[model samples]
Target: MQRLVLRRKEFSLFQAFIYKNIGISLGDHKIYLVQARLAKRVKQLGLESFGEYYDFLVADRKGGELEYLSSLISTNVTSFFREHKQWEFLKSHLASILERSGGRLRIWSAACSSGEEPYSIAMFLAEHLPNMTQYDIKILATDVSPKVLKIAMSGMYSQKACMSLSDEYLRKYFSPVLVENEAYYQISDMLKKQIIFREFNLVTGDYDLFAQKAFDIIFCRNVMIYFDRPTQNKLVDRFHAILAKEGHLFIGSSEALTDMKKEFKSKSASIYQKA
Candidate 1:
């Protein structure tokens, strides 16, 4: 990849541009990183400079170019059963949570990438909450990137994604399909029915968390690392507002709210309860 050395002013301009357009705040030090990630697109478009590419992103009216730009900027690294401790907590507390909320359950897998986390939740609920059949159990999965959301809605994955799941759960919850020497597991329709996928941008608008209803559990793990301190604070406050009384918020294992206002108190190492 060709290294495009961006000047400090140019970097700031690009950052402002993207923040205005897509709500991603790239710092000055990320110039090289941005170039590295986007160099291929620049070359493929036969652009002479990063500025030209930026202009195209802003001015492109076809919508495809803008979608491609958003796809490049968004981060989508995720795995099945990440942070197993949280899942353990969910399993332990499922009965109590359901009981406390009058047997109605709504979970928001915010920033769900390629459907792993939500599907894991569905599988867990399927295994543990047999009473879920009588109750309203729904998982709302949302992401900013439509591409990733489409993949997530498909609920198809390779064996690597299901490695953490047990054989019994795998056989019961998913069906295998052979495609070109590799097997892809498709989530059973029963489990898929419990999840609702949508496109959402956490930074730009007001989500429907504070409407008539609220989520019982909000699993927004590993998503806030992209925002600055102010953005993080705003997002956390929004989370606190939308979360039902006594609702739980699960964040990334390494992420904490030390820098932000303490609306949620730590219940466990990485879990916080809305206060």
Candidate 2:
């Protein structure tokens, strides 16, 4: 079978389609990258051309194919404790946030790929907060990819995946388990109970679903970089609306809220506090 080639016109069509639907801004230089990422999918679908794949994506009503396209195009590079500085800030200010909420806390790990970010939060809370069971704490971990969510829900990681974790954290929070004749570290049920993982697309997901929810800390790290200024501003506004007064927003170290006008004041590196 001949490999599908992404023609220039097909690239243009994809650039517009991805921008309109996924909110990712693709530059002229990204043509090769997009082709490289999408070639496999186009071939897997047995489509002769990228244009046919594009047509198939548009005609599919359930939107799963579009999601797969988004998954292929978007990056999901993540790990435990990705931003050290942000975690440090969270640790220092956690006492105040807890006091404000009177031991009740709500945290949302937006774009929590493969469960690392949310699980890291749970571990940090367990390690630092005394009488860990005393507080009414819940973490809402959401992602756009069902593929990553499945790995996250399972909480199983190989020794390679667990390498970055500290010995103390691994011993305290995870248990050794056998999976398919190999050893894997599994997150403890105690930690798992604190998190609720769900599938959510930040671009197209409805805000009305969270009408009654107010988050004290929202971690939307590393995702806005893919979006244009307009999309970024819109998302920041939505986050602000759902955040309680004096709540915090944690973005990726490389991303900034400077271009987007918002009420959040910069507290530290990539950390913002609602004022």
Candidate 3:
């Protein structure tokens, strides 16, 4: 199989398409990244070049190929409790959050790749909240890709995927199983029932779909780094609009709200409170 070089012109077309349709800003340095990631797909689809693949994607009226492209270009690298300090912050503030919301909790895990974050939220609340069954708790986990959402809905993880979790959490929240002679763990139904997974595009999806001041916490971590500053500010503004008063927003440690307008007060590094 001949490796298709993603020519500069072809790269520009994809770069524009991604920015226009998906809201991700690809810098010139990312040309190699795009070429490397899309090469396998180009080969698998029997397409000769990235340009042809791009055309096929545009011709995909149902937006399926575009979704696949989004999945490929976008980073979905996530794990359960990826940001340790944020969790510690949440632990310290859980009592006040619960009191303010009167025991009803609503959370949105935006760009929730492969379910670990939302599952972690569910498990965290169950472990910390007293008499968890007596409260109304719902977690909405969303991502742009259906492929990863399907994996999330299955609530199954390989032994390797469960590495970051504690032995107690693994024993309590997951059931060990074998799939084709490989060790796997299934998330308990109690946790699964608390979450609803859906497809969403942070850049292009309708924000009107969400109620104003609906969420107590919004986890849009690690994803904003892919967008340009304007997109990042707009995303932060939307998060601020939807979060309940004093609600917290947790972003990736590598990200910051420093240059953006001060709609949210910095509670900690990468953690902000709606003011």
Candidate 4:
């Protein structure tokens, strides 16, 4: 089998396709990256060139190939309790937030990769919220990749994935099991019961679905960094529209709102409150 080189023309086509469909902006330098990431998959599909792969992605009406492309182009490196500062901020403000909502707390873990972020929210609330049974708390965890969502729904993690977790949290929230001589931890039903996972494409998804739903906290961390400025601004606007008054928006530490910061007051580093 011959190695397929992704031509400049083919790269440009993909660049436009990804931006229009997925809201990610691929720079000129990323051509090599696209080739490196997708060439093997193209070969495995028995496609002769990157162009054919792109066509296959478009022609497949079910959008499964597009999902595969999304999984490849985006990085899903996540773990339990990522971005510690945001959690600390939530802890300090939890009481007031719950009070404002009258004990009905809704959190949206947008781009919840591999279930960790939403699960972390559940665990954090379970640990912090006093009289947790009295509160109607639910978390909606969404991501574009069904692959990761499947992992998330299972609520199982390998021993290596649970390294960052503390001893007490592990004992309280997870049950240990051996699968094929490998150690894994399953999330407790208490935590799983609080979350609902679904597939959503942030860029192309219908915002109308959330017209009636206003989230208290929207954790869209680390996702905006991949989008262009215009796409980022539009997404911020959509988030602003659906968030409750004075709701919080948590972004990745590496990302900033820039022009969109006017609509949201900065509470902490990469954390904003809807003004």
Ranking by TM-score: 4, 3, 2, 1
Candidate 1 lDDT trough over 10 residues, lowest sum: 1-10
Give a tens-digit lDDT track for model 2, residues 1-275: 77566788999999999888777899889988998999888888888888898899889999898878877887888899889998888888889999998888999999988899999999999888978888899999998888888899999989888889989888999999998899999999998999999988888899998778888999999999889888899999999999988999999999888856468899887889888
Residues 7-109 of candidate 3 have per-residue lDDT tens digits of: 9999999999999989999999999999999999999999998889998989999988888988898787889988999999999999899899998899999
Candidate 1: segments with Cα more than 4 A from true spot: 1-9, 61-66, 208-210, 259-261
TM-score for predicted model 3 compared with the true structure: 0.97
TM-score of each prediction: 0.91, 0.96, 0.97, 0.97
lDDT of each: 0.82, 0.89, 0.91, 0.92
Per-residue alpha-carbon lDDT of model 4 for 1-275, expressed as tens digits? 78789999999999999998888999999999999999989988999989999899889999888999888888888999989999999999999999988888889999998999999999999889768999888899999888888999999999889999999999999999999999999999989989999999999999999999889999999999899888998899999999999999999999999678867999999999999
Itemize residue pairs with steric clashes in candidate 3: none
lDDT of 2: 0.89
| Per-residue lDDT over 1-275 for candidate 1, one digit per residue giving the tens place of the 0 to 100 score | 55665566666767886676667788777888877777788889998778778788778877677567667788898887899899898888878888888988889998897999899889888888776699888899988788898889998889988888788878999899987989989999998999999877788755674486688899888777887777788889888888888899999998887756377788787898877
- Pick the TM-score winner: 4
RMSD to true structure for each model, in Å:
2.3, 1.3, 1.2, 1.0
Better of 3 and 4 by TM-score: 4
lDDT of 4: 0.92
lDDT of 3: 0.91
Better of 3 and 4 by lDDT: 4
